[model samples]
Target: MTKVNVIGAGLAGCEAAWALARYGIGVRLFEMKPKKFSPAHKYGGFAELVCSNSLKAARLESAAGLLKTEMEMLGSLTVPCAKANSVEAGGALAVDRERFSDSVTEKIRNCELIEVIEQEVTELPEGVTIIATGPLTSGALAEEIRKLCGEGLSFYDAAAPIVTYESLDMEKVFFASRYDRGDADYINCPMDKEEYLAFYRALIGAERVQLKDFETHPFSVYEGCMPIEELASRGEDTMRFGPMKPVGITDKRTGRRPYAVVQLRRENREATLFNLVGFQTNLKFGEQKRVFSMIPGLENAEFMRFGVMHRNTFINSPVLLNADFSMREHPDIYFAGQMTGVEGYMESAASGIIAGTAAARRLLGLEPIQLPKDTMTGALCAYISDPFNDGKFQPMGANMGILPDIGERIKDKKEKYGVYARRAVDSLQRELDRIGCNSNS
Candidate 1:
């Protein structure tokens, strides 16, 4: 039987190992936990979510939701596990972090085809291998990856803070989605112009945590996860236009849209913990608590996890990888997760599924799976592997902008996105059939 080594037990690594095992391929899964932990990690389990627990909007028309739907059709391990552990967060899929990780760990451990190896991998192993160490990859392993990918690596990424729901002033906040489009899942803390300006001033002036000398590398902020303070510094109204924009939501008390709104999303199923949506930051913990409390409902908020900034590394996939995530120079080696430049949790897991399946097919002497370009997963693969993107490539998450626009114009944004979602699902189904792959496998 053909055997493969999968490094890292993150979402990508576990998914990759599971995919290979599903195909009757033997897998040696590596993890460095309990023994070694990254600066951002505390859990000793596989597929631990170091950032926010919410998987983003769950409606099919939304990009994150569409990508997740595609993953489910591709026999994803994480998506199903996440669903099983889901908490109510309006329309978004949120999970109890510990339970979610425990579930994935249990599934991987029980899979006879996959052997879990608990040790830090420093050097790139020989033979068929899949690397999915994720963004916070550290020590000698990061060095080995840097050697392979050359200068195409990043080191800075941020996460938002989570607060206990009991601390939020319910009288000052209300639950509602923009335009009432989805379930009233988001908690909105409305702020008038004066409150907005005061909070904005405090945020921009708040002290940030300083990076170590070795950690100080030139960084480009990925637009998808831009830090809240950094975004606020761009201009007085920059934040309002970005995360705090009060475009479609009306404050129930005043029956009018406030000047700005800070949205809190559920972090787990119990609705006891909520994170500030789009509020990734690097502020000092004290500064975070001080400045963040200026928001309407968060004035006395009790924090569960303060927002943090960490090094996130990724390769120049356009130059290094094929659309199937196999290396250009070495077909036996593949890369997945954020390291392959697919940004979100679902996107990283999707890449793992592709790489694992691709590696399995190669070892079995089966034809490659030709995913349709119209599909979300296919488009992400295309973006990362297209040679034209070499010099200008940036980490990309699933979004409608990456998909080929429908030639006919549709005035309604939701209607247009709905069409994109349906088209992608149908196209993916056809491709799966062509490759003789089972979505239920």
Candidate 2:
């Protein structure tokens, strides 16, 4: 059996190696964990969940949900592990961070066909390979990657602040998830109109660390993970409608919905630490302490970790790779994950599935699966490789707009998304059946 090399055991790399191994191919899965760690990584485990733990919405009508469905259909490793180790998080698929990574790491290690290499890979290896080193590809490997894919584009991704649950004022903040769909799993910090306005003002004016010290390329902000303060600079009401939107639950004390809300989601299975949902920021340490403390229930909160930003790099995929995520100039080489311009965590994993499966098929002398354009997985693949976006490629997440439209105008947004999901899944199933390579089979 032919052996393949897969670098970085993050979500994407793990999925890629799993795909190849499951398909009866031997794999060398390289991870720089216990030996070395990235700025965002704390655990020496595969598929570490950093930034945030929530895998977005779990409803099929949502883009993230639809994307995960497609990934599972194609035999995803991470999605199933995520569901197994999932924690209560209302409508979203959230997980206990350490447990999730530990599960993935255990699975990868136990796979007989996958040989786990514990050192860093400095250069692109010969033969078939998949590079999923992610947005924070280290300096030496990143330079090696640039030797083929240009200098690439970079931006900053921020992580939300977490506080010890014991430090929160339970009297002021009540537990309830959005829309009350499931059991109350989130800690809600309700704010009146005056409190919201005051906090918004402070957030926008907070001092931030200068980006000049960190960036070598021109500054470009990825909209999906835009720093909370930067998002606030867009408009005062942005955060109100975005992360702080007070649409679902009524305050237990007032018996009426507050003007805005700051939600704290459980960060670990123990429920001792919670992170502010959608509060990723780059404010200076003191500024973060000052401004974020203004939230009604967080006045005396003890900060476990302050929100911090780190530089991220992604290749201009359209200019360098094919739809299957293999380099056009170097067909034997493949790229997956956020570095391939597929933005969210699941999206990155989906790319790995594509790259690994496609590589597996190629080695087995089977034709590559050019997934139907209507599927969320296919749309993301297309978005990253379409030549029309050559010089101006930007990272994209799974969304209905990227998928070819349903072709009928439906005034109801929910109904429209429902139709989109159904169409996509049906199309994807037919394609996978014809290919003879789905997880269920």
Candidate 3:
């Protein structure tokens, strides 16, 4: 049996391990927790969801949601754990952090094909390996990765908070999707002009957590999701136009469009957990609760996870990695997770799944598989590995825009997404068949 070592038991690492284990590959998994822990991860469990518990939208029209659906099609353990441990806010899958991690860790540990090592890796081992160390990679191995990846390695990533569903005061909040396009999954806190202005003032005044001098980098926001505080600083109405926009939503009580609306969506399947929509921030925990709670329905809100801004590290994938996430300098090693310049939780795991699958096949004298370019998975890979010599490469999350446009463009945004989803599924199925992966199984 071939031996495969996976560095870092994060979302990506665990996913990679799971994928490889399913392929009958023996895996040596490294986890630096319990022995040593990062600033965010407190528990010693595998696949710990340290940031927010909520996976994004469940709709195929939504990119992250589509990615989750794709992961399910590809046989992801994380998605099923999320579904099993879910607490319903509405449609989005949110999990109890403790249960989710525990379940994943248990499953991985019980697998006879996997051997978990409770220490940090000082260097990349010889033979087939996957580096899914995630964004907050430790200094030692990170240096090794930097050596192989060259100047593309970087530090500085931020995240937002997640709220428990039961803690919210739904009496003061209304349930409805934007423009009523979907069901009532979003918990909306309607704001009058005065209330909106007041929230804006407080948000601006909220104290920001300072970063270390070494961690300072230029402020580059991920276009898919921008931090709430950054949005506020852009302009007063930025929030209204961005996350807090009230265009499609009306206050059910008044039957009028709110001046601005703060939306919270279900984080899990059970409808017992909720997360603030577009509320990722760098505010201090106390400040986040203090100011965010001032929203009408959240006066007594209890946050399951507080908004956080931490240093997220990654390499310039386009310059350093092949479409399979192998460093150009070292083909024996592969990269995965946020470290690959693919943002968001699902995107990271999906990358790991593919990388693990590819690595397993390669060790067995099989050619590496590339997802079809028409699929989001393939599109993300192509984007990061674009051959253009120009230095500009943006970290991307799953989005329809990244996928090849269909020949017949549908004017309706939802309909257009449906076509893209169908094409992606079809394209993915062909790749799966070629790789002997059965979606039904």
lDDT of 2 by residue, 1-441 (tens): 668999999999999999998889999998888899976777888999987899988899988899999889999999999999999999999999999999999999999999999998888888999999998787789889888776655455666887867668888999998788898999999999999899999998889977643452444556776789988999989998899899987998899999999999875434656789889888998998899899978988867567766566888888888899998988899999999988789999999999999999999898789799889999888778887666545566666666665667776767988999999999998987787767864
- Backbone clashes under 3 angstroms, per model: 2, 0, 13
Quote each prediction's TM-score.
0.69, 0.69, 0.68
Give the alpha-carbon lDDT of every model: 0.87, 0.85, 0.80
Off by over 4 Å in 1: 156-310
Give the clash total for candidate 1.
2
Task: Point out the higher-scoring one by TM-score: 1 or 2.
Answer: 1
Query: Which whole-number lDDT from 0 to 100 does residue 436 have in model 1?
Result: 86
> Model 2 Cα displacement at 268 (Å)?
38
Ranking by lDDT: 1, 2, 3
User: Would you list the rank order by TM-score, best first?
Assistant: 1, 2, 3
**Top of the candidates by TM-score:** 1
